[model samples]
Target: MSGHHGLYRPGSSVLHRLPAQVKLVAALLAVLAVVAAPRHQIWVFGCFAAVVGVLVATAGIPPRLMARRLLIEVPFLGFALLLPFVAQGERTEVLGLPLSIEGLWSAWELIATATVGLSLSVLLASTTSLPEILNGLQRLRLPALLVQIMSFMVRYTDVVAGELRRMRIARESRGFEARDIRQWPIVARGAGTLFVRCFERGERVHLAMLARGYEGRMPMGDASGAPWSAWATGLSLPVLFGLLALTARA
Candidate 1:
């Protein structure tokens, strides 16, 4: 279990150099465009894929890593795959299987929407560091309290997860394997212990924060220098959207 969540991976790509604020805004806009898009528009979906593809390529992320990270969606994707069979609509036979036309179309739309949203999110996260992302949110005028809570959660999630892992390992070493369904209560108790430990750790962290001038707000760092290529790269999505509109309307 690595403790790295939302931490920046150092890279020299244009996306890495773009201001976090700009990337956050662009990501949001892209998401909006995808979500508000016409449901049956294949061209819009193609454009969305193209824009994400360009960003992923520019970010220098390996395709295999991207696929592996995106694998988290497979279970949901499996459900989407089953939709065509279960959904009620006009029936069509494909390879001796009865499939609903409306269901198949609905499934495609859902898959496209999920794919676009997930790809944008992963690309943004992979390119931008967590601290920078928080800074971006702050710049965008997100509520101070919400930002603070999110920052702390991202920072401490790994710590909590590590604690849980160690507890599990200790239990396993003691030959405490559950041999019956009735032993679930023991597992529940272990979970309760983990919660208490995490709560104690949070209190200690709060004390540590108090010792260090404990301001409710995070201090903004020096302004980051933006490179020339960032502007061009940032606008790529809009350009892609324009092209998509043209094709879709035609």
Candidate 2:
């Protein structure tokens, strides 16, 4: 909710210097490649992981930081762990316990897919500033409405979170105890109040935008200074993915 990690840290690394649009496109291609990979192909998953590893290394991001950041997606990863119990599949026995063979395979597939997708997404977010990434999306021909919504959402998320924090602190100052399950109504009311406050804030922000001549589109600076080496590095992802795909198919 803090949205603290959405901004790119200024660095001399090749990734930081790359044009945002190029990086975005390359990230999309990498995601597609990972998605297109066959479920049972362990080698293909390894290849995807290797490509991500190289990118992480090249970008000079710490492995521990990447792992911690990416771990935010683990709730969805839990679905992978659960699939082996609920998924329809051939029956098998392991350690005197019965399980579905197909379910186990499905679980593995889900984990691999989620790991690759989430890792790539986290890398993108970590390396690119939110504004730059949004601008890149606009350049890539995303609809204006979608762009505006994303922009506003990103801009106000921190504000909303700060408001929630202040509200909680104010409540706690008066000896509000959240020790009972039945006291959840207080939390619910607080959340509802926050929603109303966000709405009012949005209205004020809209009026301010109108005063500033914002006609539903935010102006963005041109990204025209990417070096050739950055593009070269970005292009390598697709080539690596293609090679991996071929290897998996073979």
Best by TM-score: 1
Per-candidate RMSD, Å:
3.1, 3.0
Clashes of each: 0, 0
The worst-scoring run of ten residues by lDDT in candidate 1 lies at 1-10
lDDT of 2 by residue, 1-250 (tens): 2335553555557777676777887888877877777878887898788878988898888898888887777788788777777878687888976778888988888788788888877777777877777777877788879988987898877778899999999999999989989989999999999989988998998899899998867776574555678678787887788678777877
Q: Pick the candidate with the highest lDDT.
A: 2
Model 1's TM-score against the true structure? 0.86
State how far residue 175 of model 2 sits from its true place (Å): 1.2
Model 2, C-alpha of 21: deviation from truth (Å):
2.0
C-alpha lDDT of all candidate models, in order: 0.79, 0.79
Candidate 2, residue 109: how far the Cα is off, in Å: 1.4
